[model samples]
Target: MNKLIEREKITFHKVKPDPSSLEFGKYFTDYMFVMDYEEGMGWYHPRIAPYAPLTLDPSASVFHYGQAVFEGLKAYRTEDGRVLLFRPDQNIKRLNRSCERMSMPPLDEVLVLEALTQLVELEKDWVPKEKGTSLYIRPFVIATEPSLGVKASKSYTFMIVLSPVGSYYGDDQLKPVRIYVEDEYVRAVNGGVGNAKTSGNYAASLQAQRKANDLGYDQVLWLDAIEKKYVEEVGSMNIFFVINGEAVTPALSGSILSGITRASAIELIRSWGIPVREERISIDEIYTASARGELTEVFGTGTAAVVTPVGELNIHGKTVIVGDGQIGGISKKLYESITDIQLGKVKGPVNWTVEV
Candidate 1:
């Protein structure tokens, strides 16, 4: 692992907000970890410094061609004062995958993990202890070479920032959300960068999301690009449904993100002897199942919300209610199980929670 150099000047401050009133990504800690990359020298000069705005050239490649990637995870403060991270290594691996897809230099996983641990430890006091609250970590890489070309840049910057956040949806009740099924403006297609956690994919999704919001829906349910019939994912999470006592999600067909939370939920559900299947699920089949009373529950999984129950889905102008328009038993169970494991309330699989 590359040794991280510590800056001599230290800035100590605190942002102790009422945990119950915390908003996602609104506030930041006092310090940030950063590293740089060059074409021939590779990554160098890793350090943790006071949080500040970056000075980049107007012609930076990231500003023009949008060569960037990011990853999100959380750190929880256990009741006994232990700072625990949930599946951080998996997030790092996915970040590397995103780097490769975006043509950016891959990060040294061990060194990055070491840097993350050091930064989080230094700012451990910023971790919130209230229920449904934790420290959100955002790591991102952006191409920095100043050029107007359409090719990948020779310079880049990687940085990690932290925020003490409450629930992503701002609801202690874990209320079910209404989703609008989008049949137009496809999010991504097969053989594209859909699976990569890059900025462009999200930028391309803003229009549809705005439309959903304007229509009084909480999120948009995306469909496959070609047929536009099969379900792909929700606006910011992976979608799952319980039909006929079986748990099912759309398989990763090179066009959907393989979410860490989604994988963990699948594992936890399967461990309970419940049937789980990953396959292409069409929207027509879901509507038919709802009509026949076979669609019992609908939920989404991601690092942000963990598990979001889908109470209603609007297809074009038609609306279908899911599981009596409330949180299903399976949704509640999965949410509780994952949150418990994350907060260190329950012992999870070995190495699932890493100490800061």
Candidate 2:
């Protein structure tokens, strides 16, 4: 087992925030895991230290060239008094893939998982016990070399922090969100860093998100970068459409993120005898399906929100309401199932949750 040098914090937050009032990522736990890497020295100094501000040089490569990657997962406090992580290894694997895409060194999978498990165990009290509340885990790596250059940095820092969070949709009951489809702005192309979970990819999405907000929508559903015709994903989660009584989602065409929740949803739906198709879906096709009364449901899947029902979509100035603008059967089932599995309300797949 890879062991992290544990350093107890001299001070802890005097009062824990009310779990019911937890806006997403607003309150952090007392401790965090950190490690460093150099070109020659490799990754070293693995430790669990007090949560504090990071001091980075003004000219760090990550500050200029954006050589960084991140991963998000959650630890749940089950009703049975056990802590569980949902597919944390998948997050580490995706992190390595993002690092490879961003010209950064890959992390040791075993060590990273150990660090996550240990950190979550040590800070188990921070995992909210309230229903629909959990400890959000953010694991990120950044270029830390102190120099101004357009190339990859010679050194890096990896960290894992925990934040107690409530519902992603601002409430335990997820209302269908209005999504704005951006025809003018595209997020990522087939041959871009869009597939990677890097910082700049999100940084480039602020404009589209702002547009969505200004348009009275809750989220932005982005299109392909080059053709701008095919559906890619939503700003935060992977988009899916229940068309013609079947599940349909945009295929991973080198641009769409392969979300852990998205994959699990597909598998879970299929297990329940629902047919899921991962193929190229177009905005026009979605509107056409809606017109034909075939588009029964629309939802987004991610780590934060196990399921986000999409009620309305504004496509190039035209508004299309999805199936009476209410949460569909599939979306509701997915949310309850995933949450149940995470919180040990019911048994999930054999390998889905890792007990801590």
Candidate 3:
């Protein structure tokens, strides 16, 4: 029987890179998935083809109006040769939600799921079996219509590309990182497209990120736009602080992203009898907790970095060290548990991992 998604394999596969020395998003796989959408025609022509460059018109809306959204998820290769995807449905649904926020047409969840499975299945060999490596799948949508007007584009292109990669923090670079608290530049406001996984949100953050780098910090910890005091996110990931045996994370305000890994960590921490609270958190409060010796651990959760511990914080001119500049117990446990669940060593929540 013919599958719903069309497939076209490449004539010759490129020489695979060394899996042990893979760079993040540096190397791409042999195949890619693509689909198109029009105002009246909806989405059609779902197909998988050989990896190639895209040709777009000069006045594409994505280049002008910036109507682009993307989602990131990984495919893990089990020790027994099976492949698994962690919370892919959540990423797909979040992609649609991002599309809605960006004035783009929604994607069919069923079609996308099918296409992802088929594409990953075909490129199973590209899934690295390294200890801390996996296949990074990037599904993105861009406005392709060549229009100069500042309006929503009539046509859009959705594409999924696969990259076999190592850790986002580099090879064997899973230790704690220094974060600089940013207050001068803001990432997003409440009414802005902050909650959406759009490209502009990231582009707007580059300035602060660069500032943090110049200040000798690994990443920037963005505060709320309005007050510039409340904690928002640390670099591109959601942040968590352990205070007096409680896991405190910034609430899912309109500006903060609802990270799937953050949610899973919260649930797992709660299951371990640790209280997890999602509310508006302030950097000042964190500093106070640290001064009082209540701050236990600080970490970040996201798709790329997974779970990253923060060892030191640069708050204005004061320097704050987190738990003796080392990975905390909670951070270690969450990282191990999540990776185990992803690799099929232990079962997680129902429907968490979709085997491809």
- The best candidate in terms of TM-score: 3
Task: For residues 188-289, write the lDDT of model 1, one tens digit per residue.
Answer: 999899999999999999999999999999999999999999999998999999999999999999999999999999999998888999999999999999
Off by over 4 Å in 3: none
By lDDT rank, best first, the candidates go: 1, 3, 2
lDDT of each: 0.93, 0.91, 0.93
State which candidate, 1 or 2, has the greater lDDT.
Answer: 1
**222-289, model 3: which lDDT tens digit per residue?**
99999999999987799999999899999999998889999899999999999999999989999999
lDDT (10s digit) by residue, model 2, range 1-356: 45456566646464789887898887888889999999999999999888989999898888888898999999999887899999998999999999999889999999899999999998898898887789999999999999885788999999999999987866536699999999898888878988899998899999989988987899999998777888999999999999888999999999989999999999999999999999998899999999999999999999988899999999989999997999999999999999999998888888799998
TM-score of 3: 0.99
RMSD of 1: 1.3
Worst 10-residue lDDT window for candidate 2 reads 1-10
Model 1: runs farther than 4 Å from truth?
Answer: 1-3, 12-14
- Residue 338, candidate 2: Cα error in Å is 0.8
